[model samples]
Target: MKKIKYVALLAIVFTILFVTKANAQTWNIGFPDTTKVKAILTGNKLVIEGKGAMKNYPRHKIWKDSVTSVYIKKGVTNIGHHAFYDCRELKTITIPDGVTSIGESAFKNCENLAAVIIPNSVTVIKRNAFERCTSLKAVSIPDNILEIEEYAFYECFSLENVLLGNGLNQIGDCAFRACHNLSSITIPKSTSTIGEIAFRECYNMQNFEVEKGNIKYSSVDGVLFNKKQDTLVAYPNGKEGKYKIPESAVVIGNSAFASSKINAVRIPKTIKTIEGDAFRYCHNLSKLKVPNSVEEIGILPFANCDSLERIKLGSGITEIGMYILSQNENLLKIKIAHKNLKFSSKKGILYNKSRDTLVMYPRGKKGSFMIPENVICIKKGAFEDCQGLTEIVIPENVTTIEAIAFQYDRNLKTVTNRSTTPQKISSEVFSYVNLKNISLFVPSDVVDKYRNTDVWKEFGQIKAIE
Candidate 1:
């Protein structure tokens, strides 16, 4: 009877300890004393009464999943970074009027969070502050807010209406990306700078308006443009059909045509530059021409245009960015005008004028391809997703292979390296490739050296070639 009593006493002690640990995990830090803050969980609602700023929500995952509603009392001065991240069931939050800032990712991935009220005292909305809040239908920024950082409301699919305050000055890149239901935006006159892709992928947006007297930006036919209208910024993703760019546009901003469904685009002669990702994922676009006045083309300008079959470059083009025309599976030819001074092509493959760097290889080109003897560098993403080539031979002069150089070539079975020394390659060059199923053939004298290299050593078979 005495022994049984002792066992029960020990069980009681363990139960008490477990409850203490769980409670400790839910408590927020930064309080001067435990008595200065009071947090009570009643059913699904969490009530936090604190005298000063609260530290970022506890890192413990348990607090995130259990809290359905949070009532932050007026004494709290700040909401720390990632305070309520990934709280799938959190539907409503009351941010008090004294709060001055909302940190990065403060409420990221709160999929069911439907509404929030930003108090007038808040000055900054940091990067990814409300990212992926899929059910949040609307929000209004108070007049005291000074900045809205990158990806602040990214992928908020249900967000339809936004009311911006007059005090805001700067908006960061991708601030409102992929908010499919947002119908329009009006930038306040006090705003001076808006970053690239700030409103990209807002599929329902019919227009973007700048408040009258704004000095840095303007709108032309609902398209965002620089105040002078020399740079063409974002084109609403919802607008479809053939659209000719204005003849006065000198530069195409980053992501200018990203995720657009336009059937055709006519870049005018006045354009001097096409920035990175300018035409990415425009699957319906089939043809493009760079006029003679153009001087540069940025990275991946025409990537993933599935129906794009032909491209022509003008004579004045001097700079071509990496992966400029990658993933256009139907692209059969890329022709450069004869008077071009910076680049050339042989057999439809693009290269620098001196032929020292292989720029990109068309994915639609068939059969085996041999790298020219004079090429020394394979540019980044040069051969990405090129499944048509069953084999490749790298010439002896080639010394470096950049990142993702040969990625996703599932059908590639053999590679012949003519270099006597093992050429170094980036770790991502062969990413997603089944190295054990592919064979690597190296010069007979350097077979062992190639076998010792990091990426080459993983080949299924390393054979000596005379």
Candidate 2:
């Protein structure tokens, strides 16, 4: 039975390939003449050779099981955008020295492509050029290239070796993201700029080397840092156990520790800023203490960390972004020091310094919750995804409830608002909730006001408080 299945699969593969070849018509990039760009199929190989530039290779599904190889001859100056995209069966490609640029997504998702020589004459590799080329094992970037664009080599799971050229100046964001088998990489001395998330999600890279005389970046214990060592750059996802931020480091670059395996981290007091998504998705991190020297905390810094339960904020943190600690299912408390001028908390719930704005309510806080009388505003996503609450009391002073303030509260059945005036709200304030089954209790004088309000009118029962 197994042999028969294998044979059937082979037959299906051949049938698809043959059908593609049957549909093969001469596709010329520009004006079709003897001197212009043209493609022709000879057996399983697609031969593309001409004196001028080819506008584009083909669409994603066009070459799925058909073409096995592509040979761009010496006179072709450019390989246009998405030329060989999603060519699953293509294994070998020969790009001649006359080609000057390989356009965006030129070889994207070519799963069977193993190796290719980019000629020294090529200068630009546009965005997503070799993204998801799973079987690609080795590539030597030519010396004349200047930049490697975003998602250029993203998610090449089996890619093991990459040779960067000395003349290359910039590596774009997420250029080599998630290349798990890549064990090491050497940054050439001439490369001055490496974009954010450039090496993130690379699980197996153990050593990051910066060639001596490189002035902009450096490496310590296989981690990348700025030349002055004040900014913490990329940390290998494969790195294990606890990590301590160096004493000299003041800034943690965005997405620096995202999706990492670290169980604990110690932030030194010298650190001043924790950028957006800096510690995002660190599954093993259970606790964190932001030092008193940190002045700003960016969005979603510790989000999606399933095990994180507690955090102690420094007194100096005056700028805190929205959803900074969102999606932490186990989070129960956030302790803020007294000197923080912009933020404060009541019983582990985050609020602005004056307690006038309810910032975030813990998702794990059980039973009923009450907003303080001083709170005039409920910020966006203040009660988002809080699965524990079944009832809530909005103080009389709260005149505003931001979008999605009570979203995803499946068990919430009652809401008592003391406000006399109809509170302003949008249509999506109670999204993903069964408002028709929930009751709204308002002040006696505001019963009609609550029942007639835009979003409040959808409540199943509206009553006047005694």
Candidate 3:
């Protein structure tokens, strides 16, 4: 009995040794011919050591799930691209002082990584370097860093504080997008270039503070603007109520007021240009008046404003972009000045000054609509999401209908086409409309032509317009 017990104990000891050996393994992830750098993993700790730049591992070479900590030795000069990507269990990282750069997506999707020490020796934080580090709470940009590339900290929901270094010269597009908890950001004086939508969708951001003597940028009332204060750069998403554009301002930057909570905005006559998505997603904005000084307006500048009810355009406008007034659930009218040479309005509907092309129809307009006698083309998304439209009359001169011209008009029950020959159009033009349940009316001589047409033939009833 004593001998058997001793044998069982020995068996247990050997099993423990085997499990330990299996859990503690090593991998040489360095390029011996080019650099002396090496990555060695033992148990849950990963150690990066030696000199020169480390090899870029787009995918994890070590057991990423098992690594809870990382210690980079002082001699390493760079952290290669995607070196520790998707290390879900990695909780801490200690970057040494000699590392000069953090490569693209080096630590992307490290969900459990709560803290990282980026040394001052680093100059560039490449695109997506620390993207989606959901648990990270704070970051301090080192003084030597020159640029923070696009999507570097995107969707880091728990990040609340950021300290920008004075040496930062540029911030790439969408660099901090969707960082919901970020409350405030200060732009350093050396930053000269800020890409479009760099701070978009930061819902809780309240203030944009610019350090004194920043020659390229400035801030007033927590709003960002160029140094001369002529161009509005960004509006904090957390602020509420009416805002009056300064008389000195001439241009509104791209996505300057996107996802903001302002109920109204007063534009001055000096403002000449409105960039794309300037006021998008401002659910509380109710009215807008474009002054005569404005010469150009970019695409979707005022799209998706749920409370927008009226827009007045002045005569000086010469250029307008597509879908500027799309998806406003409560918009009721677009009133353009009669002297305007490029566009016109009839019964609140927007059209080219010649009145030959229908540009936009308010989604809030209800009941049936009669196409004007001179209209020749229907623009794309002209009648999209107009849920109250029950019938439409197409004039004889109408020759073309663009894609999604009548999309999402779920309540439309009838369509009357006055042409003798069916106008060719794709089925996508009527997306979400129940073609089989609605009736199509055509001129008496074209009943057969309408029934034989590709997209028109799907109608439930084809009848002569007696």
* Best-performing candidate as measured by TM-score: 3
For model 1, what is the alpha-carbon lDDT of residue 12?
88
Of the two candidates 2 and 3, the one with more favorable lDDT, higher being better, is 3
Provide the lDDT at 272 for model 2: 94
By lDDT, the better pick of 1 and 2 is: 2
Q: Compare candidates 2 and 3 on TM-score and give the better one.
A: 3
Q: What lDDT does the true structure give each of the candidates?
A: 0.86, 0.87, 0.90
Candidate 2: how many backbone clashes? Answer: 1
Q: How many residue pairs clash in each candidate?
A: 0, 1, 0
Query: What's the candidate order when arranged by decreasing TM-score?
Result: 3, 2, 1
Per-residue lDDT tens digits for candidate 2, residues 1-466, read 9999999999999998998878665656642353488777666688777788877645653455688999888888888888888888889999998898888888888999999899999998999999999999888988899999999999999999999999999999999999988888999998999988888888887778899999999998888899999999978787879988899899998999998888899999999999989999898999999989998888889999889988889899876655888888778888888788888977898898988998888777788988889899999888888888899999889989999998888899899999889888997788999999999999988788887889999999999876
lDDT: which candidate is best?
A: 3
Q: Looking at candidate 2, what is the lDDT of residue 241? A: 93
lDDT of 3 by residue, 1-466 (tens): 9999999999999999888767666555555435387676778898888878877786765567788899999988899889889998889999999999998998899999888878999999999998999999999999999999999998898999999999999999999988889989999989999888888889899999999988999999999999999999999987898899999899999999999888889899999999999999998899999998888889999999999999998888886654788788788899899999989999889899999999889888888999999999998888988888999999999999999999999999999999887999999889999999899999988899999999999999999998
In order of appearance, the predictions have TM-scores of: 0.81, 0.89, 0.91
Where does the lowest 10-residue lDDT sum fall in candidate 3? 26-35
Which regions of candidate 1 are displaced past 4 Å? 1-35, 354-358, 369-381, 392-407, 414-466
Native-to-model Cα distance after best TM-score fit, residue 279 in candidate 3, in Å: 0.6
lDDT tens digits, residue span 344-433, model 1: 887778888888998878888777988989999998878888888789999999988999988888889999999998888867998888
